[model samples]
Target: MIEIHAKTSAANTGSASDRLHTLGLALPDLRGNPYYVHHRTVDSSIYISGQLPYQDGRLLGQGIVGRDVELETARELARHAALNALAAAVQAVGELDRVRIVQMLVFVASTPDFGEQSNVANAASDLLIEVLGENGRHARTAIGVAGLPLNSPVEIQMVCTAV
Candidate 1:
């Protein structure tokens, strides 16, 4: 249950709706208030929950990063996670332009020997830069984990500002 930061008045409504249509994106069916999603107010920001490497509604791969999942595969997983985050952003704000991705937190499920969280997280960060241009640049955190929900390879969460 995400709250609209922008007020109900027409003055607060901007090109967000139009941008959504132009981008051909829509909100997904949310079960409840996402741990990673939030909106303070118009011109405030949108927070998206960390997303896993899920495709076709299921996690693509799992296990230690270097052992079971290859680096390239982990990178791809992060990319998908980033895309999921974009979807969440659009849904939370009703538009993408009213967004300034402030930061990204990436978590990688890996074994003790795997220490490439930055590299893996880059996949998600790079995708955001490509999709949002300069607006995607922001502070980020990449962490290695013992495991993730459903044993996914990568997970990414984002914070975005909107008006």
Candidate 2:
């Protein structure tokens, strides 16, 4: 079995927003999409759709990882996608600190021989814990895909529970 090297947030505390500020980051104020809603809430649970690595409405990186893109680039793209997921979560619940992450699904477009999918996914996991502290720790899955929408390197979908 592969060892889990990602940081755990079990002992973390404090406001998620404050942690975000401390990290020199802010959630992007995203507008609602015309085709589909970014997230939906059923009771206390929020389901966020797959989000690409878009910053200011532009895809961050394209092409399959381990081919045209490097591992570090894919990792950063995952981080950005995770940020988009957090944005959708805030849009659904109206507050960042009011929710706790429950699960995350990370998709990486990579080559057949690329076995570092988990390593690329760690960037997203690390970002969540950094921003949400213990609330951000979650169950997660990393998937290797033949391709992704827009040929982007990474996409992230998430679930959160309002606390």
Best by lDDT: 2
TM-score of each: 0.74, 0.90
Clashing pairs in 1: 1-33, 36-48, 36-49, 37-47, 43-163, 46-160
Error of 1 at 88 (Å): 0.3
Candidate 2 residues lying further than 4 Å off, grouped into runs, are 1-13
Expressed as tens digits, the lDDT of each residue in 1-163 for candidate 1 is 0121122122133354443344454433433455534333344767677777665666778777988999999998898787777777767777666556889999998888888999998777766654455566679999999888877878888888764
In angstroms, what RMSD does candidate 2 have relative to the true structure?
2.9
Instruction: List lDDT for all candidates, in order.
Output: 0.70, 0.86
What is the alpha-carbon lDDT for the whole of candidate 1?
A: 0.70
Per-residue error for 136 in candidate 2, Å, reads: 0.6
Residue 65, model 2, lDDT: 94
